[model samples]
Target chain A: MEVRDLNFTYPDGTLALEDVSMDVHAGEIVAIIGPNGAGKTTLLLHLNGTLRGNGVVKICGRRVEEYDVKELVKKVGLVFQDPDDQLFMPTLYDDIAFGPINLGLDEQEVRRRVEEVLSEFRLFEYRDKCPHHLSYGERKKAALAAVLAMKPEILALDEPTANLDPKSVRELITAIKKINEEGVTVIISTHNLEILPQIADRIYLMNKTVLAEGESDKILADVSLLERAGLL
Target chain B: MHQEIDKYAHNSPLCNLDPRMKVISLMTLIFSVVLLPRLELVSFALLFSIALLFVSRLPLRFALHFLKWPFMFITFFLLIMPFSIEGTPVFSVGNVIATYEGLKYGVLIALRASSAVILALIMIATTKFGTLLKALEKLKVPNALIQILMFSYRYSFTFAQEFDRMRLAARARGFNPKTSMRTLRVLGSMAGMLFVKSYERAERVFWAMRARGYDGSVRMLSELKAGRRDWAFACFIIAFAALLHLVGG
Candidate 1:
């Protein structure tokens, strides 16, 4: 994945991202680290065409504009920051099957995908449970399962660990690592810097735009850079 | 209010019954009670609903509590009817007379209202809200209307939680709401803020739906099917309603 000179402004005249450029190699776990309002989410939205900006975003050698929203979603699965926002279906199974069903897959195939992803996330038991009834950690996992059921090539997560307990955070880190190992290029935007070295291969520090980008360890060790980006 | 109903719904023995069958059965009973001219037919319908409440294992106390609001409305209607409809006067209060014919008419109307409310409550108590919404969709209700109902039902709980949190925050700040203009102003602002926040949340929710590849029609993971027992139950309800219609006439 590649983004070049991306610029975006909200309708309310707020500059979300300005001249942002980054590249995510296949099978790499990329972390976007920044303070609040640092345009990390804005950039992720651009990757999947959820927000159209003034530059280039290419996935698999094709510009994002070349793909329709549905086609873009098939290749790039974007999970919202809030599980409450992402998991809108009544039950976890339906939430997971939503994408497959929308893709017009057969009922049997949809059911199969829902079960496969639920089991993959170890959320099989919560299949019939309401999303609201699930714990915050479980809802986050269910949100991931909903996206993973689509079998996207690129998995983009926004703040995957926000508001999670330590145990839940550790579990999520392991799950994300396993998902990355399975060859899906993962991009996560988070302020949680402690787990960056453990999970992310590369880190992009941002404050409204990319301030620095390098290997995860080099970026994490740079106290000055972290201070400059208001992330420390 | 919703939590209590949902709790009973989740635990009801008829939870697994097809919502379509329940809707058909209970709606038939409600309509029979409403359209029946005689009190005996309506009484039969009310008795049938009570039996259903018992069969579903819902507490009678809870059901009666749920009925309280509608019962109040029915009582007020019954109370006014005797004075409004003039007929053979039974009692006079300063020229505002209560008539024998009007009393009978009011009692019949109130009975019909109560029977309909009971039948409707039976269906709600035994069905999960999501299943109920899907059943409405399957019944060929308009998609837009169903979607509206679905969102309202889904988020009312979330809104309630938000409201509680806001109230707590206010109380923490030493804001005591009493019957005063200041209290009224504070509540008005809170409501306005809630509306604004909910509007923003709705926008984000729509974008989230779009990201998940949601089309116009919301599809469920599983389709509801009527089993042998469901069909039998529906048949029994229809036959009983028909029998009541004949016998009461």
Candidate 2:
């Protein structure tokens, strides 16, 4: 996926993004690190057309602007930072089942996908639980499951590691790596520089604009540059 | 947060009763209470005492404090009745007369309302909302309707929380928004934002549903059947209501 030059403003008239541009190659994991109020969320929202902008966004080399949402929604799954926002369904099963159903899959196929992801995430035991009652880690897993159930080719996550315990972070990263290994391109926006060492090969630094993009190691090496861009 | 009524209400034996049976019992009792033009002292005593017995078994006192409002209203109605209606002047006022017809009407309405409210309260006090949905699901209520009710109830708190956060965020941002025009605009924007947010959420939830492969039917786990206890309770309530109406009449 590639963004030419994205621009957006909140309805309250905050100019959130301006001439932001980036590219995510197929089968590659891309990470965007930025500080608060840096238009990270607004940019992330634009990937799935949840938030639209001026310039072009191409998913799988196809212009996201021209792709039908019904088809695009199936190709790129957006996971928000808060599990509460994502996992709004009553049960883990239903939460996971939601995306597949909306895509108009058959019943058996939806159940199969739900069961597959539930077991994959080891959340089979929590199939019947309400998301609100789950522990934060489990809720996050359930939220991911909700998106993953759609079986999107590209997984776009916002702050996947926020508020997670160390073990949960490791587990989440491992699961994400496994999914990446399975050929699902992972695009995540987070400040966890430590995470770059494990999963991300390339890093994009955004501070109200595209400040830097390169190999992960090179990005991490420039501490002053990172700090200046609100990414350190 | 006020504890959800369902969380505490589901443990009672009354909750385990078949919804059909409970529905039947409620219908019979309400009918008897409403049809008996004169709630004889004995029938009224039986219904009130039976309801109190139910109240003792369920977590109703805390689950539904609103139940007390009816009691107060009933008392107020009874107290004011004899003073308002005109019939044989039972008592003389400075320039008005209080009559026996008012007294009879007031007490009857009070008794009927009390009995019906208590019965309904008992039903709600025992059954959790989730269990009620399960029952409805089993009874073949449209899954879509149950789902809507379930999500609405579940997310109403989230809505309030979001609204509160927005209010605080606005206040901190120096938008005091107290003047009528500003308040109206801000509130209108909030309503619009909330509607958009909720609509978007509904869309996301639909995606979540589709991802789960929900091809429409809501297949719930195996539900408890109308066992002996459910039927027994139903029978006892029906018999009691019939006996009340018969004896009172």
What would the TM-scores of all predictions be? 0.93, 0.74
Q: For residues B1-249, could you state the per-residue lDDT of candidate 1 as single tens digits?
A: 344465678788888889999898878877877888876667667777777778888888888888999999999989988888878999978879999888888988998998888778878877877788789888888988877877776677677877888999999999999999999999999999899988988877887787777778787755888999999988998888777778877
Among all candidates shown, the one with the greatest lDDT: 1
Task: Report the CAPRI category for model 1.
Answer: medium
lDDT of 1 by residue, A71-94 (tens): 888899998888887777666787
lDDT accuracy of residue B9 in candidate 2: 62
Question: Which parts of model 1 have CA positions greater than 4 angstroms off?
Answer: B90-102, B247-249
TM-score of chain B of each: 0.92, 0.69
Q: Tell me the DockQ of each model, to 2 decimals.
A: 0.60, 0.20
Chain A of model 2 scored by TM-score: 0.97
